[model samples]
Target: MVKFGYTILYVEDVEKSIEFYENAFGFARKFVSPENDYGELNTGGTTLSFASKNLGVQNLEDGFIESTLEDKPFAIELAFVTDDVGDLVQKATSLGAVLVAEPKKKPWGQVVSYVRDLDGFLIEICTPVEM
Candidate 1:
């Protein structure tokens, strides 16, 4: 059987990235490596992990592309489901996140907003879609 365990984002500083998510979204730290080059957060269901770019270079002989302040964010994005999209969006912006879009009701009845994290990663904050 196959199951998604986590999503890893390659960052310049693992600890810094971990701290950013913790403060911006209230996610608790699960573990941070002794070397401070890798860390994980307890994001409820699937884990959110961070690995330093140095670690990525070591793991893959060929280096990987990294998000930068100057570069436009990648086409992909990470989304978090939240009931209060407006409040979360405001808080996220106050914590150094770039506001990409304000909350809006979709035709499907979901309120959604977008923000760019400290590292320029696109994040979608939205109300949960009813099943």
Candidate 2:
């Protein structure tokens, strides 16, 4: 059984990414490197780390090289569980987050809506219905 703790995303600019997470999602900066190459944001117990692409190479050894030919912008969808789905959606919209999908009740009895963050990552905010 593996427990999830954190997810790291490579960003073009760490400062801008941090500001987005803070202003949009209400995540606070928990830790940051002195050079500002990487930092962690805390949202409840989950931690999301943002690392700049240029500084990410520092983690690799000298003999190691990453192939840029296959490198491309990747898309990831993150689902966030919220008690008040409707309120959260409204708040997210007011914070300049783009609403990709309006909140809808799914067949599985969950209310969900999709939104895109500043970096174009899809985020699904959902609330489970009573069985």
Q: Cα lDDT of all candidates, in order?
A: 0.91, 0.74
lDDT per residue for candidate 2 within 18-125, as digits (tens), equals 887787667898988888889899887778988877776666545333222133224557787888887887887777567888989898889999877655567789
Q: How many backbone clashes does candidate 1 have?
A: 0
Quote each prediction's TM-score: 0.94, 0.74
> What 10-residue stretch in candidate 1 is worst by lDDT?
62-71
- Report the lDDT of model 2 for residue 13: 74
Which residue pairs clash within candidate 1?
none
